[model samples]
Target: MSRGPKKRTLEVEEIISLYKKGESTTRIAELANVSSRYINKLLLKHNVERRPRGHWKRKYHFNEDYFKTWSGTMAYILGLFTADGFISQQGQTVSIAQKEKDILEEIKRELKTTQPLYRNKSTGVYMLYMHSKKMKDDLMNLHGLNPCKSNNVEFPYVPQEYLHHFVRGYFDGDGSINFKGYTIVFVGGSYLFMDTLQRILNDKLNIDTNLVTDKTNYRLFLSGRKTIQVFAQWIYKDKNLFLERKYLEFMKEKTPLDLLEDRKFRNTKNAVKLRKQKFLEQLTKTNCIEKASSLIGITTNTSKQWLENDSDLKEKVNILLNNNK
Candidate 1:
């Protein structure tokens, strides 16, 4: 015989109420003797959302105060990195003091114009103010940190010397070159200087050597290993003509009076005389001798006599000719 008509199922609202009141879907389904799928379908049909059991909702929200604090702290860290002598703009050197001063001024200017908005209800303005204070403290701590002092500190203006020491230190530390051997290191600022030194030392001094300059770094080496300072002084005193030309180029970028500040050039008659002659020769080569000598500080005729009498200059010319083949 056919069974009586099936009983109608309970409405979705009733199922949802039971579920909200902590009744399991399985228990509800059993009580109604309906499939669990039907219970789930009914709940969805009524637009009831079911969250996973035992999951906790997030208790915190990010506010403007938190963002400002974090941003300010990050800014301070960036400022510190700059102040601590980061290489920038194709390795052009900048001092820590200069970077620090610039950042401090910028921060002060920003603070003057910036206005805070949307404070945290629980933390209030204290969180924001504390962040600012923390930034200041961090900057102060960075300022107190001493800069890494190098042996070439006495000659800050001489970039060649700075580069030389750096290279030497790097090589010595890395065991790339032995300092104790019968080794000659050609040091200079530009490739021209270093190249010239390499040739001159090879020809004149007959020394076995390596040319340590910036070019090597670009092609094969790493940073913080250039020692142009010791190399420059060595070349000047030892009368390395290749290095002398490099020094001349370096000096040409500066005034004669400024060049005189270098003890290697200033203390020696030969260095001073060689520099003056090289200056005139460079001017003559560039067709600027007439205009250059017209300046109040320069004496072209005296420079000529110095060049004529320079033994080192004569030797360099002879060496160049010999190596020309």
Candidate 2:
């Protein structure tokens, strides 16, 4: 007796693509018109790894009110959304990208969704994305985010109690402290969003900020030691929720004005005047070369040679050159 044609699995590329897009084993099987066990076998055959069973199980009965409440975690999620999340109208999907895997996992856990975070091998960027019309609607209607909200995004009305936490999250997303420049600066493409943040900084912490318009975006800079100190203290009050590296830098002992003054003092011409005074004095005298050479503890030949060759450093560096002969 002759058997029917042998069953062949779907293309390996197609299977891998669907799997990476957060498709479950059962869903992949259904899409391919094969049994779930067969799909698992194909995945193994193709060297595609499987996620944990717990990662594939759906936990919450997702609804419109799933993300309606205002909480610290919610505030943080919103902040992350503002910084890196994208809403696609075509697919009704919400996608967030980060280099850190833990953050992507945290977002996945908070949503209680059974979606895998996909990794971009080229950029090493991990993206946690899902398709949900409810989430897109919530963000659009509740938070007032637009489909393409790069340059026109606004800060949503968060509760008074959770506003600081929300701002902390936003800061973690886009804000950075320049320890070298002694400034706490927030950078964003949206002018309105940056302005709103400036207002929040003033009203919430009584810290003033300067708004600067860059070529591509807006910058809200809280310069000076006192201002940045207040900003750091207010935002980092509950340090557990923020990016640890940034928080640690903000909590560092050095003050902005102290660093600024140190830089200023070092860069000023007066700072080096004392050291060059003897050189200048010697250069002005009749035996100027000899005097400067004595001060520098160098022989007259090296000083004469250097002075004769380079006029710019004739006086200042004559004392620094030494002669062996």
Best by lDDT: 2
- Pairs that collide in candidate 2 are none
- Tens-place lDDT per residue, model 1, 1-325, is 9987545345555568655644456545653557667777777778877858654232222221221232323333332222222222211112222211333343334344231221223323111111132333333343321123221112111133233333322222221221221122223233443344355434543433343323322111111111222333433442211212234432322333223321212548776766656554545443333223322123345444544897775555445435543
Candidate number achieving the greatest TM-score relative to the actual structure? 2
Every model: Cα RMSD to truth: 27.1, 15.7
Q: Identify the runs in model 2 with alpha carbons over 4 angstroms from their true place.
A: 1-66, 254-325
Instruction: Give the per-residue lDDT digits (tens) of candidate 2, residues 124-182.
Output: 77777666678888898999887778899988888887787778888877877766446
Q: Against the unseen true structure, what C-alpha lDDT does each candidate score?
A: 0.35, 0.67
- RMSD of model 1 against the true structure: 27.1
